[model samples]
Target: MQIDPSATSHPALPFEYDVCVDRLPDIVTRETESAVRSGAIPTFVSTDGKTWVSYVDLFINMGQGRRLRDPASAFFVSPEAMRRISYSSDQIDAAGPDLSERNKVTLAGAKRIAATLAQLRKDLPPWPYDLRVPWSEDFDFPLAAFIKAGQLDAYPSGRCWWVRSVEATKLLPIGESFDDPASPWFVGPHGRADHAEVVRLSAAHRRHWPEIYGPALTPRVR
Candidate 1:
């Protein structure tokens, strides 16, 4: 599988390949792209089963300013359950020893996400999936869960708590040269669509599936 050179424009943000492959709906793609360009930040917008939850791959360009890199997460926001937890009056430490330093979180953002999830609990008849950051907002721990832990800070209010989870990281595929097998993104006998290494590639070389390579996505047995 190879990316269609003729079918793409410069992927300014990650997951732009998602838009090209029809895994992400056109409406959601357009809306997310618009918000990212405007600097609101890539967000977990919505989903209709056509694709997973939509988010942006944000980056700070050298001179252009804060913008999304070309790409979106390939993993679907897991359609799982969430438990509501409240921090004790005596705040606990937030940052878990396991959490990484590649990213940071804010107390306010943590609170906000917690509140959002709480509201979603009340609003949605059934909890959809775990509320995930647009990207690796915090792969390891959900920000709200660690609020009382003092992982972020003791700030009471007027601050947004944001966590960069190290557990999961989704990035925009920056199409670097990968014609060589040495390249992590190289397409070869093992180039399954869902391969973690393949997903990391900035390009979706899906021009030929089942023929040159097996289906990146498993085809319906039927």
Candidate 2:
């Protein structure tokens, strides 16, 4: 994406960074713009359409373990998720990365993300933040498994939000199917109620599912 440095806003804190959308796919652009128009916060976009970033990326990055394999996945955070996380629209700021520097994915980016997590540890202190390694396991949700299942309905803002009925937690073997109601991983009636409660109560829970599961989750063909 062509980044226009002059039009960006820079926030003062560590998790803060600019969001430029000039390089995003057309679907992403449309989804993001619709979210903004429907009362969601308007994240900073470069006047030159070269840079863009969103609060969801920053929020996920704040956690202990996070990575972006598919940058397009950032859009999974819906407007409701943003409100649930208590992120303020006014908190967004735009800033420019060193444009002259040729952008290349390097170990340095990974290290920087790790370092940022380390600093967050010292600055925030980990009382409220509990760190645990995630596991890889598959789970099923027949109600919403079909690609078109939930796409027909619009969110409160008249935008369609992809619905996923079942998901695997961070702990389980990779590629394992848990769609059978009898699977231990299935969210059962007598399972640890607290765990299920946390999942239901938090948007971050869904956003970071892959991290919670070390491997990709596969849908069951029930």
TM-score list, all predictions = 0.20, 0.25
* Tens-digit lDDT string for candidate 1 (15-133): 22122213333443454456556764433322332222122121111111111232452322222211112222232134446432211232333333333333322321111111222
How many times do residue backbones clash in model 2? 17
lDDT of 2 by residue, 1-222 (tens): 222233323322122223444444455556555655664533544344443444433433322122122344543333322221122222111133542322222122223444433343333312222222112236333322332354322121112122222222333346543333555434322111122212222333223222222234211111
**Superposed model 1: Cα runs more than 4 Å off:** 1-23, 40-99, 102-112, 119-222
**lDDT value, candidate 1, whole model:** 0.28
State how far residue 219 of model 1 sits from its true place (Å).
40
**Relative to the unseen true structure, what is the C-alpha lDDT of residue 131 in candidate 1, on a scale of 0 to 100?**
20
Candidate lDDT (C-alpha), each: 0.28, 0.31
The best candidate in terms of lDDT: 2
User: With candidate 2 superimposed using the best TM-score fit, by how many Å does residue 130's alpha carbon deviate from the native?
Assistant: 16
